[model samples]
Target: MDDQSPPRKGCCSLRCGLALLLHFCNVSMMSQRACLSLTMVAMVNATDAQGLPNASTQEPPGDLRNPVYNWSPKIQGLILSSITYGMLVAQVPVGYLSGIYPIKNMVGSGLLLSSLLSLLLPLAAGAGASLVLACRVAQGLSQGTVLVAQHTVWTRWAPPAERGRLTSMSLSGLMLGPSVALFATGHICQALGWPVVFYIFGACGCALSLSWFVLFYDDPKDHPCISLGEKELITASLPEQVGSGGKSVPIKAVLTSLPVWAISLSCFAYSWTNHIMFLYLPTFISYRLRVDVRENGLLSALPHLCSWLLSILAGHAADGLLARKRLSLIAIRKLFTTLGLLLPALLVMGLLYLGSGFRGTLSLLTLTSATLGFCTAGMMINPLDIAPRYYGFLKGLTILIGMTGGLTSSTLAGIILNQDPVSSWFKIFFLMAAINVTSLVFYLIFAKAEIQDWATEKQHTRL
Candidate 1:
């Protein structure tokens, strides 16, 4: 029987019609999912002050201004950090949820909730600390949800050869979100009050949530818009991916991995130095260095900007190393991890010793910011290495442990400074610098990208 030979006319017509219908359905689903994903990305990227036009504007004359100094400076910095504190609490739960649930739905829900919270910020800001903190917490909850879930989505969509570049791009959004927020917030706040910042974020969030519902699909097999070849390439390249296998990742096994612990510790160390510089730098500049709010915002943003640029470069380098097989993953990770931790440690100490009047402080600060990119090659990619199957849960563990650094640094800054802000910065930097170097040594000793034989054996059996 010649299968390709012309069938009876009526039967042939029916078969062609069925094929056309299926193709149409697939294309429609894919198109919708792509739009949804892009919208969610925009919502996640745009919610910060960087996206607002009014973030840096002068306050109303009657609004609370510190009698001895400008109060706007304190309000802006503290409020901006408030949401992050909430995020610290939400990170682990969100990560766990990503592993157990449909990541797309989790992300969509977060964007929707966060957008709603963004709309409420201006009202809450006017109300008082209690309301403001509540709104900030809401935003944090949403942010944490989006952050973890999006990574899970990428593990499905992206390929192994492209994972480094894609991971860099995805993680870079954190940098990019703030950069855009600051730029937009500066202009908007100049023209309008701070309330406009909330309004813009809210609107974007709403739009993104709707788009995600319409556009996003959970896997390559589910994506309607992708071609057969593209889908094959993506799934083929995906390792023991989270959703595809329909089996739970053994959490206990992952926790026992020495490499996982090393990655977590290294991440914590890095976040300690980085978060302090981020949360308190504005206060430090305003109080200790005598910089105005406008100038301080721009300067405070430079480090993240540099980190974003360098992360892009680092991604390309990682890909190059893998493509050429020029070095073991250990060598690549070791070089970047060493530089990442060591350079920042030295620069941090330099910042402390140099003091407020030093001529090179700004230059050193910029260098400190740039050095953070070095860690991207190591800590950022570690999840894919140890458990490509459980990227969401594993990466979540890194983030959860790493996030504690923020709390520790904040508490340290508070206790050491006696809440004075200006007097304690140097002490804080010195301690964190020591911590970074110590962690770097341990990381160099223990961290490895290659999965052990047991992991390989388990994956082989799964096949």
Candidate 2:
């Protein structure tokens, strides 16, 4: 009879545990789906802005004479890549402002401004490179502001156990934009002039802004649709918010933190690798593979589309590992961070040394591109790990540092190609590989997601 009682109790415990997990899984799936839907919309918006068609309806731009993408590849790359420069300059201010103002308000304002600016882009293009750059700068700054706020809001709403999936779901925008843009832009450029793309994007941006304002709230407490029990769970699960009176973190402390530096360095590496792929891959396909414009666009998108799928898988894996509590934080971070960089570097290097034909180069490039999805694990969650209270500010700092990779890479690629187009690409690939590897070293040595004792003590002092 005593043995029977013990078995009954154990059965009850197992049932309760399963019930709790199922509930968490349901909530997490709902949250992730919302984020994923948002990402899909954002990607469509970004793609249209980059002069892409709405979907698969149009053809890629071609010269009346040649009937292929007519814009100078280099100049087109410049047009696409210029946004990062504005984004970098805007991040710090955006971060600081978000801490003082409500995150929802910041996003609302950014979307409004971006919608207006995006409308002006088609008109601005005929004004020359300066005007185009000006519009891009405005768009980039607005996007940066919105993104800082978005990060802050996600941290507040997402549960601890579900953050990885939520973060990756949101970040799917990053990959989705490039994939959709490459495919659609080629068609849009073919069907209408590239300018028409901006008109479509601007109109869509306006619509999205309306939805965002209507649907989004800064905190779960403020969300009318949110359940009281879920709200309680979120608030209780979070570590206490840091700093004084909800004030911005001191710029100096953030600048000096070793962990921050590591995160920033890793971000730079990731950005360098990513932008190289985004900005150059199409041209590489056109020039090296001798593929037609439409085929090139479709092929280029394949790697990023693959990456988008893999990132979601990686996010779930991260959460499952956490739930099991089998790996130390350091081990977990190192596993993802190292593989993310090292594998891509190796693949890129192999392409440089051994790639001979179109098939070989494409295969190597795809593999390199796919490995980047692995970095989503560390990149998505590190902010919460190190300073959950200040995720927005940290993301701002990281973006400021990381986006330099675009400015430098574009400038350097231009310089190198000026001297010799073919040989220069090889050198650039090697350099990218080296940067990726060096960043891994920094991450392994110093990057940590755990809140520091000093930050915790500061929180107490504020209280």
Candidate 3:
């Protein structure tokens, strides 16, 4: 996997970075949209009347308190939870189609549609909760293809040895996206209004969409900005995967493959803890540990920051190991992914013993995110390892699978946190630990780096 020459300077890599930055912007908007409760809590919680926070003392609807959509906990949860439904229904189909169309078109055009949907949120909310739910779901449908579309670009853009770094770099946007959402939404809510959150982010998405189509090409050979020599390098680097972009996907084989299942389930386990902690950590810090709500808000950001920094670090390290030939790809992926899962599991286990030592628990919780991020090198990059050409579909499948785990974890959190006992919280953390262990076992047993036969042009459709 060693390269004949060092990677070309400031061509595809730069374009890749900018494309992913746009992707992160869309993700940030979605995360902000889902957690409308947080940014608009000031407006919504103005009265005790059905979840409004004293609308009488606060300014009128158009005056001081505005984001009145999330006025009830039930409606807020439903509105927040509805986007996943769209993604669940759309991802597999979209993943398949991304290979057939220009990936830039898929990403750029799709994201613009989602942004436009964001612009409609206020109107939708003004109409009714059902209208708002429909709007969010439509946005999710537009974005459901994003995972596949992003990975499809990487097939042509990233070399085998370089994929660990490049894919990680691109995918790390997942972390950076929410981090931006959390920070940006907070400031905008205070300065402008809750409705402006949708407007501003939606406008940014449209802007990024224009740049994406203008700056990127699905294949290096197709990029006007790329040099002949750089195009030659990329073309030569991905010999097996070249020209596989338009090949038909072998759906039956994909659905039945064992390695696919292993990776997908492993991803499920990782997503479970990650999303649950992200959604509930603030509540745990504020209510369980009795930290002031304002301080808890700031502290909740620590885990995401840790994951973002660690993921970038792990990406470089993984690529370096691949280039130096110090370890096999399987070994390197296992090492990184196992650390991502096992270390966090151990930390969660430790939380059970901390009792009420709130400071220690917060520190451990933040540390868990850093370890969880090691998956960027491990399972996150596995799609490229197994089938570079079909990476979009494989990656989409893994994410689709992970959504189930996310739902399960979220449900468990709702039940346990509602019960509100230190011991009940302990059981949930222990469950997260056990799930991580199960994923490690599955990955160790079944994961593979070699391309699956069904994805090969010559040997496709075995199923």
Q: Relative to the true structure, how large is the alpha-carbon lDDT of every model?
A: 0.61, 0.64, 0.71
Model 3 whole-model lDDT (C-alpha atoms)? 0.71
Residues 339-452 of candidate 2 have per-residue lDDT tens digits of 778998999989878957878988898888888887777754687687766677778888778889756886777667656865988888899999999988988898876786
Query: lDDT tens digits, residues 1-463, model 1?
Result: 3333332222133222222232222222212111211121122222222223332233232343210112232343354456657667777667666767887688778777877876775566456656766787677777667766666766676566555666665566555454445445544544554456567756765775776676677776775654555556666766455552455556566677778888888889888877776566554655556653445556656766787678767866887897799988788888878878899889878877775563577777778867887777777787777666667766677877887886678656755655544557767888888888888888888888876543543543331
**Candidate 1 versus the native: TM-score?**
0.78
Which residue pairs clash within candidate 2?
52-185, 53-184, 59-187, 60-186, 60-190, 61-190, 62-67, 62-68, 385-449, 386-449
Candidate 3, residue 52: how far the Cα is off, in Å: 9.1
Clash count, candidate 2: 10
Q: How good is model 3 by TM-score?
A: 0.89
Regarding TM-score, does 1 or 2 come out ahead? 2
The best candidate by lDDT is 3
Model 3 agreement with the true structure over 23-61: per-residue lDDT tens digits: 465455455444453454544543432343456444455
Question: Could you give the C-alpha RMSD of every candidate to the true structure, in order shown?
Answer: 10.1, 8.8, 3.8
Full candidate order by TM-score, most accurate first = 3, 2, 1
